[model samples]
Target: MHTIQQSASQVVRQVLAGKNLNQALSVLLSPSAGKNGLRITSQQRGALQDMSYGTLRFYGQLVRVLDQLLHKPVQDAQVRCLLLVALYQLLHTKASPHAVVDHAVRAVRKCNAAAGGLTNAVLRNFLRNRDALLTQASISEEGRYAYPQWWIDTVRNQYGVHAGEILLAGNRHPPMTLRVNSRRNSPEDYRAILARHDIESSLIKPGAVLLAEPVPVMKLPGFFEGLVSVQDAGAQYAAHLLDVKDGMRVLDACAAPGGKSTHILELAQVDLLALDKNAGRLELIGENLQRLKLHAKLQCGDASQPDGWWDGKPFQRILADVPCSASGVVRRHPDIKWLRRSEDIKGFAQQQLSILCTLWSMLDDGGMLLYATCSVFSIENQCVINEFLMRNADGRQLPIPAVHLNNGQLFPDDHHDGFFYALLQKNA
Candidate 1:
């Protein structure tokens, strides 16, 4: 337990130092000796992941409690992060408070012997005034919501009365939803298979299923056989909205780890070209397509610089799933709350518009391009699309039939992660 705490602290420290959470964990849990020079078992890896994510998810509140408990900041970075991790375990997990404190102290001693006493005192003080400390922490919006102040402000300003719900939703554990491969099986058939395995699930749509509990992919029956692929319920709307048809030429601009790309292929027999800037991520698209017995033309190039890769043919349908602040999916990536800045949204919006314009040039007459992002921010969603329509004389926004979406913005909720979609049709 001490080792897991120690490992988790190290991961958190890296994140605080500006490393991506997933990258930091990958390096820590690599095949070689871990950061602490210990071999990580499969079980330890799971514990480490839970601790790391939980700590960051509530980092705002934990830090506030720590501030009230301590007289001065702990000089050691590792020790500070260790206390945050311990606080999260105490407040959120079913882990025993005594064990959490004991393991944290032991982990501190191994890193900085002199700070062990300080760590012990701070944690004990937190336990003694737990209720008061929690009350104080919840006073601040950041503390109460577990998101940065700017993020809270933006959501509030954009969403008005519903900002609190959006903020709270991002801190919760995301649901595990799967996109059933309709070519191979139906959601009804898959639900029966899950029932036979004693796994409970609910049908979200024609091809999407929401699991009652998230099980490892390996534990999911026929996962490798590609009967279904894990995807957000909101994301499943993309393939359907793009309206792909047999013999249509389609381009997935900025496609990588190709969830939308594969879904498009699954829906119709189209001549699909999956393009992304990163070669490594493009490999992930290949792996997904292979597992599902699908095919597409894969290309590595910048989506904004289509001149370098355009094959002189316009696509009948295009899906530009552009990148953004990723505020919508913070539950799956808690570090984004800390890593993203308010200014970053504008930069992303500019880049998104650039990609949208470039991809627009490659759209055939009457071709539809769906501009999408996994962001709840207005600047990156409606604002960008609105600007695009103004700049392009031939392009006009199309109405989306999803009744839940407010103009094209889908806020994070119990059923789906936050996502934005604006379909544009090129007038002939």
Candidate 2:
């Protein structure tokens, strides 16, 4: 337990220092192959992940709560972060207060004995004034929603009357949605398979399944056999929007972890080339393809520099799921709320424009390119699309049904992560 608490606190500290949660946890929790590697059990690792995610989920509010109680800013980053982890348990988890405090006090001593007294005092005071402090923190929208003030304002400015719903949705735990691999099993057949195992799920669309609760993918029947995959509902639209057809050439630019790349293959017999900038991440695409028994030409190359990889062949369809602030998937990755800044949106928009313009040339004269981002920010979505259309005469924005031309925003909900998709077509 001490190891678990220490590991969790360390994960939070790493994230606060600039690394993402996945990168941070992998450093502390991932077991090594050698005998010298840390031997952490599954239960302990699960605890560490839960505490780290929960701490970041309420990070904005918890930090404000600490500021309200602290007489001065904590000089040691680890000490303050440990307090945040303890506070997360006291407020969020069902763990006993005595055990939580005791473990935290011990964990703090393991880090810095000089700050041990401070940790104990702050935690106890919080227990006494928990209600009032939470109330004070809840007064501001940022505090109430546990998002950065700039994030709250930006979403409001873009979403207007729906801003509150969008902000609140990011804080809610996202549902576990999966996409069935049609080649091996239909959504209906997969649903029956789940029922046989006493696991309940509802189909949101033809190929999408929404679980009542999140489960380990390894436990899902036929998961290893590639009968289904873990993908959100909004993401499942990519393959459909791309409209992959038999014998058509498709380019899944910026495709990493290959969810849509695999989905495209499941729908059609397309000659797909999945390109991503990171070589290591391209391996993820390979892994997913191997699992689904799907095939795609995987290459590591920048989408903005097609000259490096493109063989002068035009693709019938392209899926440009560019990197962005990821404001939409905060529920799944709460660290994005802290990691991204308001100004970063401008940089992302510029990159999206570069990739969209570059990839546009690689598409067949009448081909379609679906621009997507797991972001609700307009600058990265419609603004980028609008700017690209203005600069290119051959490219025209194609309207997506039920999606606003200016905001193809899919607000975060129980069924899907907040996402934006703008399908563009090239005209001769």
Candidate 3:
């Protein structure tokens, strides 16, 4: 347990030093020989993951509590992170408080032997004044919402009375939704297959299912056979919104891990071209296509600069799933709340507009281009689309088919993660 605490602390420390949570955790958990040469069991790995994620999820509140407990700055990043992890276990998990403190103290001694006493005192102090400290932490908006102050203001300014709900929703554990391959099975039949395995699930739509609890892909029957793929229910709307038809040329710019791209292919036998900037990520698209018995022409190239890869052929349909701050998917990735900045939004908007314009040129006359993002921010969704429409006289926005969206923006909720989709039609 102490080892797990120590490793989790290291992961958090790395993240605070500018590394994203996923990359840091992967480096620590990967099966590679290192100085420690420690072998992590599956159970230990799970514990470590929970500890790291929980610590980051409520990082603001935890920091506030720690600040109150400390007389002066600890000045040691390692010891500070260790206490943070221990506090999260005591506050959130069912772990024994005695064990948590003991393990934390032991873990701290290894990194900063002299600071072990400081660690014990701070954690014990927090336990004694848990209520007072918690109340004090909630005094600040950042602490209360567990998001950066700018992020809180941005949402409040944009969403008005509903900002609180949006911020709170991002802190909850995201639901694990699955997209059933339409060509292979129906949602009702897939629900039955899950039940036969003693797994409980609910149908979200024609091809989407929400699992009662997240399970490993190994436990998902026929997962390797590609009967279904894990995808957010909100994301399943993309393929349907693109309105692809058989024998049409479609471009999935920024396709990686190929969820939307494969869905587009599954809905219709279109001539699909999946393009991404990274060679490694493009490989992931290929792997998903292979597993599902779907075929698409995959290429590694920048979406903003398509002249290098385009064969001078125009596409009847283009899906520009541009990259952004990923504000909408924060529930699934808590690190984003801490890593993103206010200025980053404008930069993302510029990039989205650039890609939208670049991809617009690739669409045939009267073709439809679907702009999508896993972001609820209007700057990345509506603002960028509005800019494109204003700049191009021929481009006009079309209504999305989903009723839940507020002008093509789907807020994160119990059913699905936040997503924004805008369908634009070109008039020659």
Candidate 4:
């Protein structure tokens, strides 16, 4: 029990210290706690995990609830984190608030001598004002920077008011998605695998699967065997739309932890070159390939200046999954809601446009290029594609209809991550 409190507090402290929540938790639980020996129950372990993920997911709202309930600030690192954990349960979890307060008060006792009275008083205050907090936290920007104000405004402006609400709805929870490894298992075979494990999932498209209840990959059948990868159903569609074929010379630019790159390889036997600026992440890409026994030429290089690394020979197909604000995956990384600023969006747009222009020139004549980003904002999606069409004199934007989603604007919306794909075929 002492170890559980210490571990939970350590995880929360790292989150408050501005480390990524998932990475922080991994560090906290590395090889399990205890300097010498301690036996932690699965229930306790699950609670710590839930407390960490839940608190981060609703961090903006929880802090507001805490502020409303507490008079003096719970400033001690452990005490503050205890409050976050407690507040997360009081508002979000089905656990009784009294039980949550009891456990948190005990955890606080382990923190500081002064924390017991403060924790008791603050949690008692919460019980009294729960109704008011629910109303305030849900509406105010301070209470819910879980959704950014400028992002809210921009969504309203670009997509109109109702669509703005829909956009927010998109971040409420993560969509469960899967990418079928076409080399080992087709979409149909993967769904059958899910059925064999009593895990139900719907096939969204040619190679995409959407799970209603996402099990841990370890629990999923054949996960270690890499029969399928947990990719956004929308992202799964990229390799398919890319039209990678047997023995084609292809470049998967900006590929790190190579999901799409591997998917491209799975779809067809191709001479593929995968490059990213980060060498550390390249190892992860290599690990995924090793797991699947898939082969590809993986290198680390800047996508904006591929000439520094790439040979002069041009490729028949290029998959440029460029960097962006990653606003679409916010549900899975709630810290982004607080970390991102309205100013950052414009900077990302500028960089994304620069990358598009740079990589577009590298596409061989008569070759096709698939430009993708896991960003929901139009400025980073269609805006970049539209601007490219206007700026390029020689390159013609292939006219595609809304149905093909190749119309220079493909927003992957069906049971997938919010992704934008632009397929451009250079004229021969």
Candidate 5:
């Protein structure tokens, strides 16, 4: 079996190639992992995943350290990723420095034989002058906090006084919050079940519970029975604010992995039609529905073009949880920080607007459509909301709990992902 560090380097290289963390890890760890993949035990997989996340969490700083250590870039991607993984362990994790260096040297040899001596020298140098090297790297904002300068500036400009808090929160390990399936059990009962299993949790709202520490979904009580779902507290708010009712027709545009779609179904027997652009993602929705013992009409089509998917029927309620830069949930998906570009925000805003306008046309008169994004950007949040309201005379902004009017951004905190929600009602 390949060492954990080698596996982690492979995962990191995949991420650097533009795949998200989940996708990269899945490629490495999945049983059907490709020919170039390494097969390891579950425990090793967990170790690799943790190491990869730690490296990416401080990627900017790590890259800077590499810049200082190496005279030139390592041409081989795997060898470079091995260097990153080793540095992350030596600096961030509690792993023994000697062991990390030794394993990394092995990783380099495995990745490329000629690079072994280079890896050994670089790691030894870092160990000897670690303090000086790290201190030197910390002079820049990116090195100090491990986020891009443009991203840091954007957060500061957009959030003003609270920018630091958002940036700090983005680097944290996100909490694993759960939404109780109210159809089968109350939040209190589920909490009691968790207590029985020695899992400590507290209620964030009536139906949402925040674990004191995250546990695997399989470990949670009645997880397979669908007594609860792993969802962020911020995401759980969307279903609550949607106010789904029995027999009401609802459209869940851009629904994937069906977290909100399932929550809506759990709350009430809605005639929900879940739409997503990708067929592969639609399968996730189906799996979620089957596990929850709930039903929703799943459609694979673009939310931007209703002509391809929507029938002539207007829905009483719609949840337009459109795509955005995903700045709010960076703690959960650190790859977003590196993958997203400055120009992407304006493009996302335009796409969000298109979906909103198109979906609004499919809403019944006086229907409520909850517009949402896991983004703190004003362009994607307030800008799209305001422009859509202006373009559509019938669109009226309705207030909900925790919404700030000054800027529609919801700053991230311990309790929730950075999310923005705008409840709009169509005037009959």
Candidate 6:
């Protein structure tokens, strides 16, 4: 295992190269390039992953602290990133500030023109100002939550003051929740099966279990056997909402990585079509379907342009898990906080509207469509649904029945990622 300092330096270089934290980590941890492409042990690998994720998760506040202490304009990208890494270690990492700076300075030396002196100066300066900087960064909401200024304001406007805090908390990495395939084995049955392998799992809800420790799916019993699969509890609502039965046609629009699509099949026999815009993502859908020994007509096509891929058929059910700001799942992908812009919400709503309008014709009369998004932003959630309802000429809002759940809107940090679901039925 490489020292955390060395790993931090590498992560710093990746960040300096203009990559977001998750992107940088992906490359650094990509078996071919991480740790100089040397194979790291499993334990070391896990630690590096944690540090990289944690550092990026709080980069906003970390940078603020760095700026306060180092009273110089940081010009070089590499050195700037290195300084950020040094500060991250000092604040969030277990490394001693002195050792952190020493190793960072050496890392700088390895570059063509080492900034060892500057690195040393910056690190020591941060150490001297640590107490002050910590206090400053912790003073405000943005500092405390580590979100962008606009993000803080936007979430506040939508979810109000309290939910805004919840939104920020949700941006932390989500837990590894799994849904057992009830068709194959009951939840308790699977829990006992996992116990034999020392895999402790606690049932959080019926059919929903949280692994005490997430192990590789390959190591889990009946994973390849299709008894359980990794899925967030928030997402499991789809199978019931669609409520597929024998001899029904179902469309899983935007079904990349096919979790919901697979779950739908698990609930009952159905003629399923899982369509995604990206071929690469569709490959994952195919792989999951194969692994589960499930059958779905997996194809790559744009949901907004169903005519291009549709075979002139109407479906009894549709799952339009459309693309949106992804605000709800930010905890699982904290990089969305950095990678996404405020304007993206408007654009996502526009795209979703197009898909909803275009795909409406594909639904059979009296058939229902479940509109869903892993986004808390109003424009992408309720507002989009309202607009679509107003604009569509033949659409009828399906009243939420006892069987059809009403998940009005979920923001982040509410036990699950924020999500919105609306079930609509067309007049037969």
Which stretches of model 6 miss by more than 4 angstroms?
A: 1-39, 96-98, 112-114, 124-129, 398-407
Candidate 4 — which residues are off by over 4 angstroms?
1-13, 31-46, 142-145, 399-414
lDDT (Cα, tens digit) per residue for candidate 1, span 206-320: 3589999999999888999999999999999899999999999999988999999999998999999999999999999999999999999999999999778899899999999
| Candidate 5 Cα deviation (angstroms), residue 204 | 1.2
Report the candidate with higher TM-score, 3 versus 6. 3
What is each predicted model's overall lDDT from 0 to 1? 0.91, 0.88, 0.91, 0.76, 0.87, 0.77
- Per-residue lDDT tens digits for candidate 3, residues 1-428, read 99999999998988888899999988886667486544789999899999999999999989998999998998889899999999999998999999999999999999889988988899889889999999999999988998889999999999999999999998889999999898999889999999999999998753589999999999999899999998999899899889999999999999998999999988999999999999999999999999999999999999999879999899999999999999999988888888888999999999999999999999999999999999988999999988899999988999865555678989998889999999999996
Clash count per candidate: 0, 0, 0, 0, 0, 1
Every model: Cα RMSD to truth: 1.2, 2.0, 1.2, 3.1, 2.1, 3.0
The digit string of per-residue lDDT tens for model 4 on 182-215 reads 6677788888878988888887754578887867
Local error of candidate 2 at 169, Å?
Answer: 1.3
* Ranking of all predicted structures according to lDDT, beginning with the best and ending with the worst: 3, 1, 2, 5, 6, 4
Give the TM-score (vs. native) of candidate 5.
Answer: 0.94
Clashing pairs in 1: none
Per residue, candidate 2 scores C-alpha lDDT tens digits across 230-296 of: 9999899888877788999999999999999999999999999999999999999999999999999
Q: Estimate each model's TM-score.
A: 0.98, 0.95, 0.98, 0.88, 0.94, 0.89
| Whole-structure CA lDDT of model 5 | 0.87
The regions of model 5 sitting more than 4 angstroms off are 71-73, 403-408
Name the 10 consecutive residues with the lowest summed lDDT in model 1.
29-38
Candidate 4 residue pairs in clash (backbone atoms < 3 Å): none
